[model samples]
Target: MSTITYYLDMQRPEQIIGKPLPADLSVVECQHKQYQLNRFLYQLVGEPWQWTDKLSWSDAQWRALIEQPGHRTWVAYYQGAVAGYYELLRDAEGVVEILYFGLAEAFFGQGFGGPLLTQALQSAWAWPGTTRVWVHTCSLDHPSALANYQARGLRIYREEVEAEAP
Candidate 1:
């Protein structure tokens, strides 16, 4: 595959502000902050896989996430429609949080997640009283996710490398 380079700014998620893709790929704001968090948690809590299950969502659920503070949502438009989404939130402690992030597979390897993540980290590094930055991922359920986290320079502070499903 040829080299694909995508650009995104750390201070402004709006810079990318791609229009929602019209095809199967599209990004949208979460109905609620909790639902927004759930988007990142597909593997966790036994939620249906966005990629495998056609990724259907309820509009009512999305509206609630939009009302919360410290929650930011933006959809990726592929071919003029929303294809994927990235969310960023901050806790009372002032640590920049990667609350939930998802992208249509078509957008991967084209330079989306990496820059968005890098910018999130950059935002965290720039924040005051932020001593450390981190993200939570599993080694077994989602192997690629762990690799991606490492690639983003997030250290593994906790590990359950062999947690058998209950």
Candidate 2:
């Protein structure tokens, strides 16, 4: 599995990147100049649930995301192994929202994504002066990710089509 390092991007919606993890699950911050393509992978990979960057990513794309603001990324380490990753961003009102997220494909369904998400959400929500959070996934009747959010206490306030891409 690939391990991603995080660095802060200060362009638009500022964020903390990398936020690395150590062998025993300790967290550290990472700073690098390459672009990370996890978001692009989520946007262009296989089906929604099975979607990911299942290809060898190039250096240029990864570096661009590193330089983009309002984006954050992090990798989880379990027993010295790179286990998964996720990112968050804040809205204009200072509420943290999930921007991109995924676990190592091999770690799927082994009970990792949920806890990792739980931990990340807590960290985001705990940020001072933060308020409600909202994340939108497919609203075309696919329910797994939505269900997970509801189970976690995120009320589905409204249902709508995918937000137009920029």
Candidate 3:
């Protein structure tokens, strides 16, 4: 199989289109490092999309990745239930990368992706010294993934196709 990966970036905060969260939905940062919760979320939101890179991550690996100084996670709650999540990491040069972003299987098609992504971008830009915010999505992701990113003002910076084992 061939997987197409698109790299997107926002050079300024004003670039974001800004979608407001619905009255019944809210996004909050996971202030404390919790590898277990992060692992669960990674599995929960990424299973259908073939997100296997972190599936084999040991507890210490997960902790080291998430417990770093510039890493952050945000979760979206729909009426108090876990709806979706995104993770952001800022590099030394002030670039914040949205490492992972997705909604749960149950939350699809309910108009959550846009607003959730907006919040993610806002959070990314809000980080101190942020010069750029970026993310990558592949063809394996939800069909709306690329559209949502573009609609939110992230411009394509690069694209590549890779062979994947079936």
Candidate 4:
């Protein structure tokens, strides 16, 4: 399959504000728990093409990636069950990337996506020395992915088509 991916970035922290989450929904940082993080990644991005990056990694490699400094994952909970997650990676140069973001199938269409994304973006901006925040979404992602990022104030800065192995 081939995908046209859009890359987005926000250069100013003041450009967006976090939207309020439903009372029952909460976001928590995943604390060095590789197994749980892997499980969430698989379940949340279960659609075939959506999770290929991490799915193809060996256990050790996956753990090493997650353990790297400035790489963090946040899991969202709805009434205490895992609902979704977003991972962020910050490079030494002060650029933050929304490495991955998605909701599990069970949480889809429940109206939690926007708020969860808002939280993710807000958190990214809060990191010290962050000069920019960015994310990429392709055709293979959830239908609302790009729109959600735009709604949260990320603007498309570039896009291109690329082939993906089936």
**Compared with the true structure, what per-residue lDDT tens digits does model 4 show for residues 53-128?**
5666677887777888988889898887888888889999989999878888888899898999898888898888
Best by TM-score: 3
Which regions in candidate 2 have their CA more than 4 angstroms from the true location? Answer: 1-34, 37-65, 68-70, 139-143, 161-166
Listed in order, each prediction's TM-score against the native is 0.52, 0.57, 0.97, 0.89
Candidate 3 regions off by >4 Å?
Answer: 164-166
* Model 4 spans with C-alpha error above 4 angstroms: 163-166
Please write out the lDDT profile of model 2 over residues 1-166, one tens digit for every residue. Answer: 2222222112222232222332355332234422444544344323445544434555666555556654566666667665666666665677667665555555556555556656566666665656655565554323355555555555555554434455
After TM-score superposition, the amount by which residue 58's alpha carbon in candidate 1 deviates from its true location, in angstroms, is 8.6
Lowest summed lDDT across 10 adjacent residues in model 4 is found at 44-53
Task: Write the candidate numbers in order of decreasing TM-score.
Answer: 3, 4, 2, 1
Which stretch of 10 consecutive residues in model 1 shows the poorest summed lDDT? 1-10
User: After TM-score superposition, what is the CA distance of residue 144 in candidate 1 from its true location, in Å?
Assistant: 3.0
Per-residue alpha-carbon lDDT of candidate 3 for residues 1-166, written as tens digits (9 for 90 to 100): 8989999999999999988999999888999889899999999999999889989989999999999999999999998889999999999999999999999999999999999999999999888899999999989899999999999999999999998877
Pairwise TM-score winner, candidates 3 and 4: 3
What TM-score, to 2 decimals, does candidate 1 have? 0.52
CA RMSD, predictions in order? 9.7, 9.9, 1.2, 2.2
**lDDT tens string, model 1, 1-166?**
2222122112322222232223444444554456544444433322323233314656565545545675565555657844455566666765556655555555555555555555455555555655445555443223355555556656555443343455
TM-score of decoy 4: 0.89
Instruction: For model 3, name the residue pairs that clash.
Output: none
